[model samples]
Target: MKFPVKNELLKRLFAAQGEPVSGQDIADEFGLSRTAIWKYIKELEEEGYEIGSMRKKGYYLIKAPDLVNAANISTYLETERYGRHIHYFSTCPTTQTIAHEEAQGGAADGTLIISEEQTAGKGRLARPWTSNAGRGIWMSLIIRPRLAPQQAPQLTLVAAVAIVRAIEDVAEIQPVIKWPNDILLNGKKVTGILTELQADPDRVKAIILGIGLNANQESEDFPDELQSIATSLKIEKGEHIDRAKLVAKILHYLEHYTALYIEKGFAPIKLLWESYATITGKRITARMVNETVEGTALGISSEGMLELKLDDGTVRGIYSADIEIKN
Candidate 1:
């Protein structure tokens, strides 16, 4: 997503990436006066780019900020394909909803749908996902994997691993994956992954992975019910994070690990998931829609199902459930 600038001057500025572009050069390139070019340079500075303007040597981008808009993200993003096309929204119903529509309309793979806030964000089982304005990462990534529909569930775990790795890379905090979806920090959920697929009975058309990560929220940002159950990277790290950089890192690792998953089987990802597993070898409750079962978690199966050792001296594979780790 390109910014709505009068001209493509911003893209050229970033393309330069520190080498000074003289006002005369910009004026000639954009067919504007030197004064008009200077006005545009000032606008870039006001938009959080620490550009240096000299008397005659013109402007040089000294430092770029970590704003979570399309312009800012494109400035710092280093991924090749994952974030090639980003659709940004200030406020939306949900990135997932729009992503589904886009995917149905034949949007490209690795197209990212991101928003500042989600008014009606959804979680597994129709739970409300809290997404306050400018506080968290409410984004959906579209992927077209050449796999069967059954392999679609593996993408959720793939996203979990990517998110955790990205959090560690950027926030310097190690997050734990709770079974299939939630990424936990200090026993509270800091991120959630919701994977929705557009597929036939045998093949997959596209996978929409909604990643909700709390990057810079304060304790007061969450509702009363979520205050105790949710945490943000800022709250845990005691400093505000660079949301754009974090998102860039996430997209980088996501593209890498997703490609790895497509090539290799789930063996490698399963190993990484176990290293961050908090429920393996613990007592837990699986709250399914029909029945709730209590068991000892014996780790996950080869195919990514939760393996539960029930009290009946039998092991059961859980497909989908709300897991609760009990003492």
Candidate 2:
């Protein structure tokens, strides 16, 4: 496979601090010709990077735009396992779709597929998730868990708890999980989790957990339809969020939770998930695929299914549904 010369050159240039780096220096470092280095520099400029060059003063990086390059993410992660294998795209239909394909083709566990913009992103229940270009974190992780197929649903809950914990750690905002799989901030949607599994009746082969978080979008960045219901970290916190730091925190929490779940089971993570969950012990209605069930939300079971105490003095288990907290 050919190396990404532009990415490598950018890395070296950034490492040079404010000093001007000669094209010959970059060429000798990468064992390439000066012409090749110049070509790569032109490509980087075309990608919106402002590189300043003088007749004999060498090249200076004036600005490094926040582009979601795989090498850059790997450099930020600086790890070998999780997020080490990253596939980045400028624009795609959906990161989840690409992740699913990669998982099917035997991608390593903890592989991440991220995109700067997703034109056809989807959320839970096949709802459209709007991700403005370069505005939010549109990514998916592929995990191969050694668990029973029946226990796979718990992964969604695990991801939610991890995300909530990460948000609290970095942004100081206490986000909540709305049942089945949705993260909310101040009663507005901030993050959406979708878990897709390739498994048989007994065991799971691979699981793809897709997460879409509105990070740095301004209020006007969202469409008129979503302004009232959807929110971003910037909108909620009145500041631009560091997407790379958030991604690191999330991956750290996810790695921790996955290890704990495999060792002690979902009981431990379930407790943490319930602790941050805001929907429990409230009057709500669950909109399932077949019908909507009105009930008092009790809590999630050990298997990660929502236990709803319905009317007429009965309780029911909801495997998957959309939950609305009643007034």
lDDT winner among the candidates?
1
Query: How do the residues 113-188 of candidate 2 rate in per-residue lDDT, one tens digit apiece?
Result: 9899999999987889998898889999989889998888899999999899988877888788888788888888
Model 1 pairs whose backbones collide: none
Q: Which ten residues in a row have the lowest lDDT in candidate 1?
A: 2-11
TM-score of 2: 0.84
lDDT of each: 0.86, 0.83
TM-score per model over all chains: 0.89, 0.84
RMSD each, Å: 3.2, 3.4
lDDT of 1 by residue, 171-221 (tens): 898889998899999999999999988999989999999999999999999
- Model 1 whole-model lDDT (C-alpha atoms): 0.86
